[model samples]
Target: TPVNHTFGISGGKQFKVGADNNPLSFFIVGSHGTNYSYTGELIRNTTSDGTIYQDQQGDKYSQNINQLVLGNINFGINKAHNLAYNFMMVHANNQYVGQYSGKHTESHQDSNDYTGRAIRQQTNDNLLFTHQLISSWKLSNKMKLNAGASYNRIKGLEPDRRENYLSKQDDGTYILTGSNRQKRFFSELKENDINTKVNLQYKLNDEFDNTNSALEIGYNGRFVDDKFEAVEYNFDALSGTFPIDNLQLDDLYNQANYESGKYTMSVGELNTYNVKKNVHSAYAEATYQLTSPLTANVGLRVDNVDMTVNHRVQHVEPGRESIKKTYFLPSLNLKYDLNDKNAIRMGLSKTYTLPQSKEISPYQYVNIGFASQGNPNLKPSDNYNADLKWDYYLSPSELFTVTGFFKHIVNPIGRVDQGNSAGLLSYSNISAFATVAGIEVELRKNLINRVNTATSKVNRVSLGLNASYIYTDLEVDIVNTPRR
Candidate 1:
């Protein structure tokens, strides 16, 4: 005999706005939410062992929104010829429901019965636009130059649904010996992205000379298009009764009846799947300073990945693929000032990550009591990191610091089990390795001052404290592995 249950929640939000005078500004925001839940279990049997019942229930709801218009404008005439604008919109929704039931009894016959139910829903939406421009120039002796450009647009949407059921029974009037199942699912997705960027800076001496140094370069790009759709449905049923009581089984089942004869039947199935993805990227970076504690950084990148798959079952086959990659990264930093309160710092870096589009997309789904499959030959993971730091300042607000780190990781991905007991799963890429070491600590002080209450002067008292911790160790060598 055991039982447990819980529920508690409340929510609110609201706003309104209107104001204009050329350099625009407008706003509106809203929100709402809810929750509910219940649980149960009961068993009774005195002296003869047998009587049990159980129950469960759940519910949820949500809502949201945001809208905005912002501004600043002046075409040209000096003051750096300015212009800026922004517009935005967003929305959200969520829902959930659940249920369960059970029963059992002995001596008076009826041994067991069970039932279950579930439902879920979700929604999301977004829209945005932005623009900007600024310029300035002056070149002579202590030269100067500044430039800028920006533009962006984005849109998104998502949808989801789920439903499930289960049943079982045996004995005393609740006749239906046992076996029932049901499933339903639906999904939708859409996305779009576009971006642009530009910037430049240069300065040559003007009493601002640590032996003169200032120059930078930048470039950015992005393009993404995505779409997906899914659907599924299933049902099962079984019936039983034989021997112990057969009253000639209704005249031997209508004398072995046949009018379109097709006996012993059970069948129900429906399925669908679709997928698409496209992504592109471009990046560039450069920064330089060859004095005042030396520094330099460099970067270059390029990428393209594409995929497509469709299925409705019939030996099931439809596929498309594309991949292209290029990357070169360089980094360096050094600082030395062993005076006026000590200092030393050093750094190095290189990084890359890519592989998750449902782990390469080959699509297969049926959840909870399992059947999930996806793996289109996945690959792409790399990292290299180095660090050293030491700083100390005893007075002028007191401080002390220390840091050391090292990392190396490559091609690691996992999920495996494919012998099935009516549950199947697969996804693989592993040649694993891991190592990590960490330390961080901080402390601050200022406790109490100003306390005189009889009518304000108690100027908000103070006390402060902080703490941190991290530790990791992992080693794997393939042979039925699971650790996270």
Candidate 2:
């Protein structure tokens, strides 16, 4: 059935290399795919008093993708250490083709009604790559160590995006005689991320299960760099011969038109932005069992973040931003076994949410019906969480669970409509605090009866489902500004 919408081919290989004494195992996989998709959309804008109205919409998309993965694992001759390396790359060609037509009828005196059409074509190239290296070693009989590092990068480019509009006249003919009638948009974005971690675990006693006690310590580092730039061009048509019925865009936009004084172009907006983020963290955790039916795990972590942002527009104020934050996060988890088939769990933690690079940049982009801008002064939100859960084991292949949770957040970030304009949107802090509460239920069942041993076995027929109900509360002050 999938063949009707998508066509793809894939293959992989597994091989060994190096000396037989140490022997490295390698794996390689690759795939290619092409897909076509279309979505139906209807956009309507109307006044609250059943008065003015406008409608516009379009949706069409297609893509071609290719991916490759390569990895290798090796064990030392003496089995002292194990190591692995992995790399992956994916590339895609994407395009969106849409013809938008709209009608505006405002219900008011001294107002005029109009209809127009727009031609839209957007094409982009996207690429992603990831690389990782990992190693494990047994320091002693009760201690083990793990270290790993990873790097990833992504790039997106739009060389040319065309959006041309034409308006209808009293004679029932279309002409390009309005602002922003012919436009071209171009943008490029690239992001690089690097992360590294080192962890060590030590056993307190000889036991390895049930009454086992252990301690873990780890160090983590993360670094990110992102850069983005975009430029828009507005074109003006000259006096020349043109086609109206069944118009062809490619032919009409020929370079000869510019040389023949039939088309002129000017820059509209130029936006550029860059971001750098660095985070370092250290953590320690301990797990111990105090009783036969009860176990506890506690952890403490400290994280420090440094971020910088720079954004500039052609004719607007240049933007510069910097932020530094430190967090002391603590977590606790407790589990109690009420019986052989039932258990209870409780968890408490303190966490925070970091702002994405795009969300922290002061950049604005406008489309047909809407315009959006980011906030450079946004702050991260701090969260306090608590949860209680009960789990039931109906059988070796079945499970049921119910959970209740609550969270409180400070300095929550949200999108707000300026109210002055129906299409203007911006991001800011919503309020002082917000509360979220939820309840969840989950179930897992086996459709076929198979092995019922204590060890986990592969199940061919299994089904799982979960559902949740949540309530959220927040408050904000509204601002009124007259639109021009």
Q: Best candidate, lDDT-wise?
A: 2
Model 2 C-alpha lDDT per residue in residues 1-484, reported as the tens digit of each score = 2232333444444445455566556666666666666765565665434444567665555444444444454445346677888788888887777776666433232134667666778888989899989888889878989999999999999878888777766666777744656888999999999999999989875233653588999999999999999999888854433444687866766799778877788896679999999999999999888677888899999999999999996644897888899999999999999999999999999999887876788777655555567778889999999999999998976899999999999988877655544345667777788899999999998887666577766546888999999999987754653322
* C-alpha RMSD of each candidate structure in angstroms: 27.3, 4.2
Worst 10 residues of 1 by lDDT: 41-50
Quote the positional error of residue 162 for candidate 2 in Å: 1.7
Residue pairs with backbone atoms closer than 3 Å in model 1 (clashes): none
- What TM-score fits each model? 0.26, 0.87
Q: Residue by residue across 293-366, what tens digits does model 1's lDDT show?
A: 54444445444545454434322365554444555555555666567676776777766666555555556654
**Superposed model 2: Cα runs more than 4 Å off:** 1-23, 45-54, 57-61, 64-70, 74-77, 104-112, 206-212, 237-245, 367-369, 420-422, 450-459, 481-484
Off by over 4 Å in 1: 1-185, 189-231, 235-286, 289-348, 352-382, 385-411, 414-429, 433-484
> Local distance difference test, per candidate?
0.45, 0.78
